[model samples]
Target: MDKMRAMELVLEAKSMKGLTFSEIAEAVDRHTVWTTSALLGQQQMSMTEADAVVDLLGLDMDVARALQAPADKGSLDGPVPTDPLIHRFHEIVQVYGTTLRSVIQEEFGDGLMSSTDFRIDVERIADPAGDRVRVILDGRFEPYRKW
Candidate 1:
């Protein structure tokens, strides 16, 4: 099974089984964010992780194998996100990207966050107005080397 096909199957199984990404992550011994990305084909899974996901979701070996393949990064619909939920993220970056960069650089110096060592978390904050979403993006800082 190809990666996209595997993702489709995983999604289908997840829905059919009424499984949450957190539950799948627990079964595979991984973080919910990372496991969700892996199951969605944005991240590759180790053999053990793939096996666990496949077993839990009742997927096939072919799907497990597909899960181990490298991801096709940035599979967005177009230049701009059309989905409301996803578009909010794009809008956030558009509004706050420069401010974030400045603040981060002021503290960390001339360096960029390393996606290779990144970890993201999503939290729900309780409030009377309404629930709020808090997304945390944490990564190691990598400075540019002066050759």
Candidate 2:
């Protein structure tokens, strides 16, 4: 992926979104004229700036890195599988990473819940109202203090 090409694509795509250069720059959290001129191919992005541009544009990880360095194109033998259930689980992990971190810090006063020392168990229980699934999690704690 050429970084210059990616920037050009972003600039061209903005027209489809009906956004002005300044509007597009704000949406990407960059300075208006800088982002505009860069997108227009008036300036080349340094490696660090290119990385930030990639993140701002939400471009593919491979495409973003390829702007700075050569990218390895790995091959997959067959069709990629799509499982909604597994996708939901992945989403849960992503959201929970932040939410659980905040909750842990609040509960433990800037401490952390450790994955290395973690344990989990799941079981089904029969209740008068309904059958239910239960999960138990335990982990070691580590604290952080700021100077």
Candidate 3:
């Protein structure tokens, strides 16, 4: 798995669900796959566009650093973190991912659980029964496949 290619594909898919490479290339001004020239400052993203891409792509500091700096490419299709913290995070998603998928699929056909175009707010709501953790997520729905 090519990390760069995979990142590109993920971003493309997030931006345009169920679309092909050509379609994504058309939507974004940048090349379908990031190029060396772009990294070397020959090409650039406007601040807003860059931020949008970052959010849409779910890119972290490590990925941003990797993109800005060249290094030996590692296996993209590899095991992820198994540390306790990571496992806890994974558990949240695993538990929620399927339920969210089912509900979203029922309401919006087949698409993604949009992290982009989404907002998350965590709050504590006091109840006579107990204190509850409230997580509110809002986003536009995009269905990737037909139900």
Candidate 4:
């Protein structure tokens, strides 16, 4: 099966099985965010990881093989996101882009964060009035090369 088709089957099986990303991640012994990303085709998976997910989701071996293929990455299909939730993230960068650049440059130097060597986390904070979600993007800072 193609990666996209395999991804669709995986999603269907996951929904039918009523399994959570956290559960799948635990079964594969991987971080939830990374596992989710791999399952969504943003990242590649090892043969073992892919097999475990395939077996857990009751999917075919073709899905496992597809998951092990190279990822295309950056799955967004437009210059600007139309989905409300995703758009909010784009809006955040639009609003804070300059400030974030300045802050990072001030603290780290003239450089960029390494998305290739990054980790993300999502957490829930309980409050008396409401619950809060915290998203953390942790990436290695790479100072600019002065060649």
Q: Summarize candidate 1's per-residue lDDT along 72-138 as a digit string, tens digits.
A: 6545444668999988888655544543554455458787889999999999999999999999999
Candidate 4 local lDDT, 58-94, one digit each (tens): 8888999999999766554447689999988876565
lDDT, residue 41, candidate 3: 23
lDDT of each: 0.81, 0.56, 0.48, 0.79
lDDT tens per residue, model 2, 60-128: 655455444432221113333369866554544443444355446545767887779999888999999
Candidate RMSDs in Å, in order, are: 17.8, 15.1, 17.6, 17.6
TM-score of each: 0.54, 0.35, 0.37, 0.55
Better of 1 and 4 by lDDT: 1
Error of 4 at 7 (Å): 1.0
- The Cα RMSD in angstroms, rounded to one decimal, for candidate 2 relative to the true structure is 15.1
Q: Which ten residues in a row have the lowest lDDT in candidate 3?
A: 34-43
lDDT of 3 by residue, 1-147 (tens): 233553554445454554433333344456543332222222344444344444545555443443443323321233556898776556544434443454466457768767688998889999999998787888888767645
Query: What is the descending TM-score order?
Result: 4, 1, 3, 2
TM-score of model 3 vs. true structure: 0.37
Worst 10 residues of 4 by lDDT: 94-103
* Candidate 1 positional error at 14, Å: 1.0
